[model samples]
Target: MFHTILSQLVGTAIALFARVVTAVRGVWQGVEPVPRQRVYFANHTSNGDFVLIWTVLPPALRARTRPVAAADYWLTGKLKTFIGREVFNSVLIDRNPQTRREDPIVQMVTALDDGASLILFPEGTRNMTDQTLLPFKPGLYHLAQKRPDVEIVPTWIDNLTSVMPKGKIIPVPLLCSVTFGAPLEVIEGEDKAKFLARAEAALAALAQEVAR
Candidate 1:
């Protein structure tokens, strides 16, 4: 409760900075809300991806959308720790677990049951690419399979990888556009591979939209 209040306060300040950066650079955001419980999946690129999307989301929806981040990377230091818990309200998952028994689905299922939306990067790890969107892992497909009613929305963030790669500290403000594609629903008896393919295809379609 205290964390949420603090987050709303800090998030507002961050959003203002993002607004100016996006506005001056002519960034256009196309945002739409899904009525049912949904999973927002996007291309992984940079550290800025979380803030960029969070800033553009509507105030009411912002609190509900939790970004699933890498535990090892984002959980370091006091400031990152605070923001991860408070500002982003992210689900810190162990992407590269030493044990073969590691699973994100268990935690994801719990969150969905609690009626909160999720933001996931299907690639599992950040892929710094421009021409091609990475092949998706089955994690997203599994999520959709378990929660078929969930509105699985595929999104593309143009130029984010280039705007700020892993090592770079400063982000070169570009006209980054958040392109949202139509939601991909899991049809009855849909195979996991096909569902995963559709998720990738959906992102590819949106990436092409941004290129146009």
Candidate 2:
């Protein structure tokens, strides 16, 4: 369809632009990016985090990766809604605690059930500093439990916090790097807290590695 073509075109353009703007360096620590279902979870620090992550992925893999974003933000305007839904193939969810028509967990589970890999920020919101990450929510734990076969890849992005700081409007060009660490394993009979702690540690370790 026209929309699908347009989406791919726009996505490709943005990904190209991101490469030049951020000077992104993608480092996959000995892990090959296989063509299969995966959950790409990372530390969120800026609005551009997902785009940068998508840009680092190979073109073929990028087509299958969808970022999980907030519906309230992406659905606010017509252009954003179109780009989020069509271009990025984002999985939008309602984050408002007061009003909710659908469960975010179920929605994400449905996306996996349909065979689409995801890019998720387990922190749920942007952290003030790239060095420190917020405590992860329980969503990742639940998702991992649901899809035992799907690999959950822990990613660490450096310098994005400085590129687009929390409250800044103009972005600064920086040498940002995206490091895809080893796949996270869910041990048998692991509880939510323990799994979340392990996931956080895995991501933190990658961040420290990237800092070096």
Candidate 3:
């Protein structure tokens, strides 16, 4: 009961805050926001990227979308733990595990198998530069291989890097747009490096669209 109430409150807060402070605009290309099993991948610029993405989603869809996050960061404090588990329904993973047996991919695949959409940061960490994006990590490729049927969509969050630049706690009020590009295609038996490169290019193209 408490978790349900917290989730509702968090939803309301994000809806209002996103509209009032950020004036966030959402653009969909080649696909519309609907209740579909998908993996929404994006470039990680700020710690709040998932929040912003979750905020922009349509309410019903928002309820079903879960953000993939790091357990160490979100599980550190009581308030954060509640928000991460209850509010956002995040699939928190141990990025730096002590043993090789601890795999984040297993967690992500489990979420997909349970019929939940995911919000992922392919970059793995926050970017410090002004470039469109840093190189994407291999987790995305592995995840794709695991869940081949799920749609992989490339999303870009513009101006977020400046809104809450890395290492800064306070967010600057700014206008940012979240553009959801078309689903990325998975070729038959594609190599890891080649697939990752294509995925990076797809996101970069969306960023370019935002710039225009």
What's the lDDT for candidate 1?
Answer: 0.76
Model 2, 1-212: lDDT tens digits are: 99888988998888887787798988889468778898989999888999998998988888888899999899999999998999999999988868879999999999999888999999998888534789999999999998989999999988887888778888887788899999987698899999999999999999888878
Give the lDDT of residue 118 in candidate 2.
97
lDDT of 3 by residue, 1-212 (tens): 87698678976886788677689888888579989888999988788788888888998888889999988889999989988898888999888868335588988899899889999998888888777788988888998998898899999988887787777887789999899999988797999999999999999999888888
Model 1 steric clash pairs: none
Q: Which residue pairs come into collision in candidate 3?
A: none
How high is the lDDT of residue 4 in model 2? 85
List TM-scores for all candidates, in order: 0.89, 0.96, 0.95
Which stretches of candidate 2 lie above 4 Å from their native place? 129-131
Separate clash counts for every candidate: 0, 0, 0
Q: Which candidate has the top score in TM-score?
A: 2
Candidate 2: minimum summed lDDT over ten consecutive residues — where? 124-133
Q: Pick the candidate with the highest lDDT.
A: 2
Better of 1 and 3 by TM-score: 3
Candidate 2, RMSD to the unseen true structure: 1.3
Please list all clashing residue pairs in model 2, or write none if there are none.
Answer: none
